[model samples]
Target: MSTDVLIVGAGPTGLALGIDLARRGVDALVVERAGELFPGSRGKGIQPRTMEVFDDLGVLDAIHAAGGGYPVGMIWQDGQRVGEHRMFDPVEPTEDSPYDAPWMVPQWRTQRILFDRLEELDGKVAFGLEAVGLEQDEDGVTVRLATGGSVRARYVVAADGGRSAVRRSLGIGMTGETVDPNPTLVADARITGLDRDNWHIFPPRGEGDGFLAVCPLAGTEDFQVTAQFPEGSSVDLSLEGVRKVVAARSHLAPEDVTEVRWASDFRPRAALADRFRDGRVFLAGDAAHIHSPAGGQGLNTSVQDAYNLGWKLGAVLRDGVDEALLETYEEERRPIAADMLGLSTSVHRGEVRRGEATRQLGLGYRESSLTAETRQAPATLRAGDRAPDGTLGGVRLFDAFRGPHWTLLAVGAEAPELPGSVRVIRGPAQESYGKGLFLVRPDGYVGWAGDTADGLPRYLARAGL
Candidate 1:
């Protein structure tokens, strides 16, 4: 009946947060209204930045084993392969940024991986237990569940979907507009007569109809079928309905769609919560922001949201740091969420391509209150930038940053005595990160940078080192 942190929802956001907290030994509980994990392949694209996060979280190997690189898009007209279209700009992997491409894994599989990781860390999730009402005080939160039980926690997170019951219980309002008026049906189906090498696209034959794209889901024997409908049109999610749509749009017959594994329909929209926090409760993922699934930013942003909040919560609860550190969650992530919302909308409207911006490697908290740049002239890797990965002192930087701790990269600089909690890696100057003392945060961002350790101790003190 009691926990340190209670999370609502078992989606990628909640599962990811649970994994981070469990690894940090935080007493957290994840509750899902549904009996099982999400059954669809929605939000299947994992951005490179999220891949890095997964690497640190100890699930990258499994993710790599279960997913594959996105195939090129194949255009089709009158049942003939016409041309090839690249969904994203090509980028080569480098020492600084290893994962340069988006990896495809069904969202359901991603959640399962996170769930298994959570269990390995002794974390727990109660399915079919929905938080119907919530009340918070100076000490903790008391949540009323639909299953006739109450859970008390020091803090609560709403990782539920856009129609978050927890957010509603707190009376939070979301403001935004619909990204598209037309309804879209996205489904995972087993089909024949299609090679699993490229994403097949069939343009609408007439004005009253809409576009259809059937993409081979990597690492699976299934294809994700996405079809658009006219404005004010209702989407049909039945197997027969899907067959009709496919047969009418493309050359595939109705029986080609042998099985409809899972299906859902929605109109693309973007909305951001009025606020992410209220007293001891917070909103994250779709509970915080909603995005059109164009540039594959929604799930990645949501997972990063959990990553951002996990360390702060661990610090406050496990390490006895100031609660004010929790304030940075909203301060830093809200702006990023807003920017990603705009980017997803733009990508949906065909204004931008899935390029470098969509990778999310360049996003950082340069203006955050926690960032401290003491150098007179900052280089490409500033204090508020992501800590680039490279070999330092015969060790990979990511290996040093794997656990729940800060890392001090004393590249080409004299090392100083630091707290045991902060891991220090000394090495020669690397091209990506110029010679300097770079203090990496627990979430892999450069928190402080200076020519020496003159201000390092001061910064550490603020973080309760």
Candidate 2:
């Protein structure tokens, strides 16, 4: 089959990119090796920045409905509640930043939501099909599948997980370090005698023991169990093994641990690909960067990767923009991925707190080549910054930016004559945005800022507006 984009893996990254491409009327297909969607609660914390992306993708309401805010951490000693611990530093919602904290949703539920949204948009996902190898020419890429069938596409994205076959076939190298020598066993289980309010934490009782935490998965009856093991220890994922660990660590008995729905073990490690792209194939999500699950940056970063590349791919294929626009994807995302890797490692090592940095609201691309700042002196809001949400001329800024179109906010500055494709919002100066002509990209970052419309036309032309 022939298509415009061929995405490998049906995880969040691939499904999200498929949804974005489908909404833009791009012919894209997602191929997954697994027979069904991933069934796990591995990456459960959704940061605030990702929440905004979900809003634009038309899945924010479903995401909010499927999950709830994180519960406080309850420390335990001798089967009694000792003290309360906060998982994240408390932050209140503001006008510009509405989602101030992380939301808890099982990874399985999140992927299910994204898949449903993709199908709602008529996006196609072919499961049980794997890309064993691929060859790209100047015209397009031809992927060889394990079923002996092939898919031809103009561009390809490898959203496959950490051991990405596509990335390996391209000979891309990843450099990283093991964040922790201890192995961690994570599982979803049905337990008794544990209230579904706070996350119960059990400290190591004696030497050679490890910590155990049981957190109630939001919007579900299952509780996620996590236990640490000493270095070089083998983890048992069977029901009896889980029961033994739970009984030994917490106040629960073997009978209280009723079932083990899903379980896995892994040693925390941080790694980044040598390059995100090689020829026509690009790596994304765990295929591009691997993160420790401490600060909840892994899944959030992966979804944002798809969000960043989606519009650019649409622009290059559908719009008459230059293909050079695609080059900025790695240039913009790689550094951000590297920074998030460091943050995740820090949070894993207990060197950093999960506060403003973990929220991912402050991430921006001020140094990117795509950003153009024409103003001699800019205020707090400048080019390469995220476009804050507020009301302008009785119109909600987010409502104006909810679609797959560029937004031009003329706040106390006259908007220049532009193409009909760009959505323009005009009003007096607002408290958050200040007074400026801000050109917002499809991904919600300000590409250019100016005091007037003097240089907006040029910036828009360069941005293919």
Candidate 3:
């Protein structure tokens, strides 16, 4: 089969990229090695910045319906509820930042929502098709599948997990360190003795013991069970083993865990690929970087990777933009991934608290080559910063930034006539933006900011606007 883009793995990254490309009318296909979607509550925390991305992708309403707020953590000792611990620093929602906190939705459910959205956009995913080998020239990429088939595409994206076959096939190396040597077991099960009010935590009773946490998976009846084991200890994923662990660690009886739906084991680690791009194929998500699940950064960062690349791929494949635009993907995302990896490691080692840093709203590409800050004096909201959401001239900023198009926000300044493709919103001087002309990129960052439209035309031509 021939296509514009071929994506490997049907996780959040691939599915999100598929949806974005489909909306932009780019012909893309996602291929997954597994026959079905993942069925675990592995990556459960969706950061606020990712929530904004979901809003632009048209899945925010469904996500809100399918998830709930993170509950307070309840400390348990000797079968008594001791004290309450807040998992994250409390932040109130504001007009500038709508999604101020993380939302709790299982990774499986999030992927399902993204898949459904992709299907709605007329995108397709081929299951059980593993990318065994690939070759790329100056024009396109040719991928050989294990199922006795091949695909040719203008570009290929590796959204596969940490042990990515595509990354390995490209001979790329990853630099990483073991965040924790102890093994951890995470499972989803139906329990009878636990209430869904708060996350229950059980501290280790002895030196060699491990910590255990049982969190009720919001929007579902199952509770996710996580347990830590000593270094060099093997983890048991069987139902009986889970029952034994639960009974021994907490006040609940062995019979409390009635059914085990899905379970897995892993050791915490942080790794980053040396490069994100190799010829016509690019690595994204866990394919490019691996993170400890402590701050829930892995999946959030992975989804953003797809979001960052989707519009660039659309511009190149559909809008005939310069191929050099693709080079900015790694230039922008790699540093963010590296920083998030550090945040995750810090959260895992108790060196940092899950506060504003974990929200991810502050991440931006100020230092990227694509950003143009032409203003003599930039404000807090400047080029390369995320455009805040608020009302301007009775039009909601997010509503103006929704579609796959750039936005020109003339805040307390005269508007300029632009191409029909660019959406324009003008309003009196707002506190957030001050007085300036902000050119918002398709991915919701300020591409250029100036006091007037003096350099707007040149910038527009450069961005293919």
TM-score of each: 0.99, 0.99, 0.99
Show where candidate 3 strays beyond 4 Å.
Answer: none
lDDT of 3 by residue, 261-374 (tens): 999999999999999999889999999999999999999999999999999999998988899999999999999999999999999999999989899999999999889998
lDDT of each: 0.95, 0.94, 0.95
How far is 213's C-alpha from truth in model 2 (Å)?
0.5
Candidate 1 — which residues are off by over 4 angstroms? Answer: none
Which residue runs of candidate 2 sit more than 4 Å off their true CA positions?
none
**For candidate 1, what is the TM-score?**
0.99
Error of 1 at 282 (Å): 0.9
Candidate 3: Cα lDDT at 351: 97
Candidate 2 local lDDT, residue 109: 97
